[model samples]
Target chain A: MLALHAPASGGARLTAVNVAAEAVGLVIGDRLADARARESELQCHPADLAADRAALRKLALWATRYTPTTALWADGEAPDGFFLEVEGSAHLFGGEDALARDLGERLRGFGLDPKVAIADTVGAAYAVSRYSLQRLVIVPPKGMRDAISPLPLAALRLPADDCATLFRLGFKRIADLIGKPRAPLTARFGALLPLRLDQALGHAGEAIRPQLPPPAYQARLRFAEPILLQEHLIVATTALLEKLAPELERDGVALRKIGLRFFRVDGGVQSLTLGLASASRDARHITALVRLRLERLAEGLDAGFGFDTAVLDGLAVESVKTAQPGLAVQARALTEAEHRARLVDVLSQRLGAASVRHLSPRASHLPEEAATPLPALHGAPPAWLPPPRRGPRPPFLLPRAEPAEVMAGVPDHPPAQFRWRGVVHRVAAAEGPERIAAEWWKRPETPSTRDYYVVEDDAGRRFWLYRDGLYREAHPPKWFVHGLLP
Target chain B: MAPSLRPAAPPPLPLARTPTEALVNLRQTIARLEGRPVAEAAVPVLRFGCPEIDDHLPGGGIAPGSVNDIVPVGYDATPAALGFALALLAASQGPAALVQSRRLEAELGQPYGPGLQDAGIDPARLLVVSADSEADAQWAVEECLTAAALSFVVGLLGAPLSPTVGRRFSLAAQNAGHPLVLLHPHDTAGSNTADTRWLVATAPAARDRFGALGDPRWTVTLQRNRNGRTGQWILESGHGPHRFRVVETLADRPLPAPATIRRRR
Candidate 1:
């Protein structure tokens, strides 16, 4: 694939760099001018950043199905790929060694020139993947620095000029600076190199960083015997929660989100995450959520009568104030909102995270787009007052905004008549043309302008409607049926 | 000095008078759900980039002691809502939890982490959690909210979530000071009973020239809320994930404020 798509002006030709790697007549950074002069037939194509970004994004998207902590090393102009932190599930592809081979083969099959290395750090992995050319090495967590020390300076994610200068200074290997004093390195090469070195060696935090972290809570147990009962797992989790509760409490934290991890005897991590309607650091609250999830797990807490450890995290927490007694609303019955919140959370545990949502109001005049839906667990309170008095709202709002008929009206006047769900309904009582202009103040692509109206049908079914745009033949001022009023 | 930096004395434990003191808040899913109802209180509002978010939250923001989480399309996918949540929490006076994953990628950048702090969450209150598998993610969700320590918990899960799990977690969140927040992408299979499930799609940022999150049109569907009314809220175009601001029910749409808001998606 690389050779076929090398570059083409009218026809195709091999790039100078490939020819150099093949012929050994020259090397990278030897001066493109020099290489061109030596091999007049070499074809050169300027690097395409946009193409690289697109490819990287595509690859990232594909990688995401596997894990959320993938990191790309395609910064700057280097074709250097990325480092995926598959630490926990590396075995899903059949252990680390097999994972490396499978990933490399898969990339090859995808027509990507991929070299993979299972290393501990992003820098080390990048170096091994880039320079290990012949083999994909799986460096055990504790023993990675030595494996990378044998590679050249180019593997350090450093610049070519700096690499050459380091080689000239006899600092050829990553080990050369191991025990050396920092003053000389600082004085000679400035502080950046040392910082980079520390980051690579894990002494300094490289902070590759995840887009959105998983959770912060963790529960674990070191059992004397592997118990088969699922209750044991609960006990183990309780033990770990005991350890974590204090920290959370001291920090004024709560668990709205959590992750339960089970590091089995055979070197594997099994986990379950629970989301809550409210956040708290109380362990029992977390345990209840987990009990429901664990019970439904396909594996069903099997421990072969003996297991090693169980852990939990996803420390999803929220803050609550320590208000003085009688300072807030008095203790009251379970409000409808609270009941619904519990129901939503229970439903999520029974169904899935996206199954439940709350009706949130929107700024759009478009009915379907008028009020938004949010995760029940994360949604705000239900509105207590009446639905918007704007115009006529429909009785039901579909997942997607379905087509509705447009009636004649300018601004706040009720529409004369409209067709909905195939039937035409006549307007009985008319109230408005609640002008819901586009949110143009924020974006250029906003709707031209929308004029929403609330019109009650003769049958007493209040329907919310809106015009997509002001009357215009070119654009056809379309209208839509939005929401329903009780 | 770190010890000296601590407050002279934390006065007294305020929760000592409540039933919570006697109950062994075992990090259970049903712990919060099974307990007596907690009354509505004046909770500190967490301003999501969108005003609609604030509107749904008790007190016009995420009510204190609520559990919430994000579901992205996948790990590599952008957790737009998660980002917005973090920014809101970071700008808050309390701490926030950042759950970690073991499969795909792992790096917590200051540039991104502080985006929440920049908005208003207390950076000092941030917590980081890493779970090895899906089950662990669920357990962590319950654990964080069951405890009265953390202010918020954020998670990135492999699946959408089930109804049972959602209820238990919500219960845990109520009693403790913490709230659970997760990021479940679109691909997270199955159903869930989340208090508010937001279906966030991408839209161009409003003013960010060099790739910043502007006011993206999020198709926020209130899958579950009181009154059985599901709808969407159009957030104004702005600049980053947190830049999208919710527009009011223009002209004359005013919903009766919820008395006790326990969830805010």
Candidate 2:
């Protein structure tokens, strides 16, 4: 026999009792001393509220597989219990009764005894699931009134003191308070009496917000015993992916990002996310991607006792349709491009999203300002103009110009001889200075002007050099090698 | 999924006296016999309208699905190589990709969208991705080459590529029928396997009526040609409707600025 003790007015009281303790007439809320007096051999363990709350939260998140909308039924209202609004989702498991059976069977695997009920109203469902002798009562739509009529007045979800007050008025059953007028009930027991009753009867709407947005596609697997091997995890992942493929296909969408969650037996969760450069729904590709990511983090993903649950979710999705081919010979398989995209997806998974990029040109006159580098999956490519009809822009522009020493003929002439970065170059043929001034309004610090010259050395190597500021203004303007022309 | 059936190829026809008229007749007959529409043969090459530039390139222009290299010859040739890369990207069909490392992007002044747009490469069609290192950039390029969505991919490598990496990129590009142009500084061109390697250098800029700088120009020297003879051309852009033109003269001869004088106090 096991008993959970919590601090109470009478020192400590039994908050919960196992079946053996219950069989011996040890009801909950009884003082610990009284329970000991009744059954001297009973074992009592101090209740850990924090641990219990954490366990409940984990269970709530796990229930998201059955329905996206899952929430705690408010503290004290349903201790260690949650609400899963499985309105349109019950069919996935056959029906509400089947879903309840499956849920109970799976939860029992986790060593939990769960009470599940399906009703049109949350209040009625809560009351019936907890008090019904069957442990599973599914109330059909519009049947909430009769379904909860036999339950005690306490089943209305009211505070304990208020339920006792109603009981004192000879209203022991919920049916007894149903016939009474609302005004008299409020005048005596308060407005909550009728309001709670109305809520349970499905006459008023109750809001239950989801913890997060529901995944477009999701599948979950539970283990009777925790498994630790990476191979076993991969097997489980493949099975879940197979289950999820049909759902994605039905929606005519492919997943861009998939997330895997491992629920360890020690109450810790390990989540890994895999992103694809292109949308895909292929089970083999998805499984491969998962393996690639897992391989990178295998050592760190400690199975700590082992994982009891594995959940796979399609975190991001994009619409995809089969491409039609013009010729049958080429249509038998993916075109070269589609094949390439799939390869990119595989490589991206292994290398990371930062590896794949697209180069876009921006509208700026400054040599370095002319192009924008963007992440492949993020922003759209910018609009393009026709190729320019001018001197070729350097393939690469140094972030900053490197200083150089130069000897030139007369004032502001192209460098006749120069030394840059420890190398001396003799000028063969040089072009004139193309003056480009700083945008003073934008950058006040660079009020100096730049005189750029395209100079080719005797070795056939061309360099874009600039003398910063005028010679008269700064003694001798500093010369810099800004770029190397191929 | 099972593939839809393809109509069989048309039977071979006899040679005709008038080739052009016979070709038209054969195409119409093939279309009629297939009972389905047939598309025109895809062009294997892209011609840059300018004769001087086209005359030097194999097949008279750029190959649609091949690897090319643009190596900067000197200090300021990086921007020229980047410009030529963008110009090729602009001319290529479909979306393009640019893969470089963060260090390279920083060293080259992260390409500004406005500048790239002005250079003629549509900013919208470009997807730029920065890798953690130079090796990663090459790997990214190889991966991006496999994606059929991109018409081409451009990789900026600061160092020479190992034979394995170069071969991998070349094979991937060829298999995917996608072009890849690697940009490397001249000094680092070691054991490159690209079909063509152009040494790009900044040439003299063209002058407008007011003597201001006009369209940019580059002296593109074909350093390595696998299928054609080596040659050099001075390519200019932004003149009239023709976006590119090869000029014969090396210098624009701009009027020199007046000499400055110092007044002693």
Chain A TM-score compared with the true chain A, each model in order:
0.49, 0.62
lDDT of each: 0.55, 0.73
Error of 1 at B134 (Å): 26
lDDT of 2 by residue, B230-265 (tens): 777778765234666776533332345656332211
* TM-score on alpha carbons, each prediction: 0.38, 0.61
In terms of lDDT, which candidate is strongest? 2
lDDT by residue (tens digit), candidate 2, A162-230: 888778878899989887778877887787778888889988878876665677678888788999988
Task: Tell me how large the interface RMSD of candidate 2 is.
Answer: 5.6
Give fnat, all candidates.
0.00, 0.40
How well does model 2 score by local distance difference test?
A: 0.73
**Model 2 stretches astray by more than 4 angstroms:** A1-55, A66-69, A75-79, A85-121, A128-154, A159-178, A187-191, A201-207, A212-486, B1-65, B73-76, B91-94, B185-187, B200-211, B214-221, B227-265
Summarize candidate 1's per-residue lDDT along B1-265 as a digit string, tens digits: 3556655553233344555332222212133344544434445545564655554543344555554444433332243444444444554554344554443222222112122223333333443444556666677566556544446677666555678887777767667655556666557632354544544443222335553222333334444442124445544434345555664332224555787333432
Model 1 lDDT at residue A38: 69
* Runs off by more than 4 Å, candidate 1: A1-217, A223-235, A246-253, A264-270, A294-308, A314-344, A351-370, A379-390, A398-401, A404-419, A424-479, A484-486, B1-265
